[model samples]
Target: MLEVAVIVLAVFSVLLAAACGWLILSQRHLAALQAERDAVRDQRLKELSKRLDTYLTGSVRMGEELYELRRVVAPLPDKLTQIEQRDPSSLSFTQAARLAGMGASVDDLTQSCGLSKAEAELVSKLHHAQHPTS
Candidate 1:
């Protein structure tokens, strides 16, 4: 009876040791998988940052070009007034008529030829009557 009890205890000990070993191996595998996932995520984040930096650089260049364009166009309104003042009624109406034929808005004619909005609209209407579009 004592020998039988000793044998049972030994078998139980062997099974307990095997279970501990399996648990240790599973924990190590889980840790390795988590580490790999973290590395992949870090790589993707770096790639996205690079793309954002490139887009920001392009936006800066476009902003600079727009600033230069504004500088170039700053004196245009004054120059236009000077020319219209020198030429008087004939040149402005001719210009307005041409612009009206080309689909200029009333505001465009008012700004470009110094005409009132009513006059610009009248010219636009006359031009449209002379040449109807399809």
Candidate 2:
């Protein structure tokens, strides 16, 4: 009876040891899985950071280009005003051309727009050439 009791005790000890071993193996596997997950997360973070940097760089470049374009275009209105002031007679010519476009006769262009008869004739001829009878 004592020997049977000893054998049963030994069997329980063996079972306990096996349970501990299995627990240890499970813990190791869990740790390895956690490490793999961390590695993947870190890789994804690095890729996202790189993409963000590229996007920010492109945005900055575009901003700079816009600033340069604005600077280049800023003087255009002033230059156009100066040109108009320099050649006031050009305004009369423009009026004469518009009168010619509206089917006004040469006499009307000369009288209304203050153009010479020769200038009125030239504006009428140019307008007819550009807009022929269809």
Candidate 2 lDDT over residue span 51-90, tens digit each: 9999999999999998986676566445435644667767
Q: What TM-scores do the predictions have? A: 0.64, 0.61
lDDT of 1 by residue, 9-109 (tens): 99999999999999999999999999999999999999999999999999999999979866755654454456456667568767887898778998999
Alpha-carbon lDDT, every model: 0.79, 0.79
Error of 1 at 94 (Å): 6.9
> Which clashing pairs does model 1 show?
none
Estimate the TM-score for candidate 1.
0.64
Q: Count the backbone clashes (under 3 Å) in each candidate.
A: 0, 0
Quote the positional error of residue 14 for candidate 2 in Å: 1.4
Off by over 4 Å in 2: 1-5, 92-134
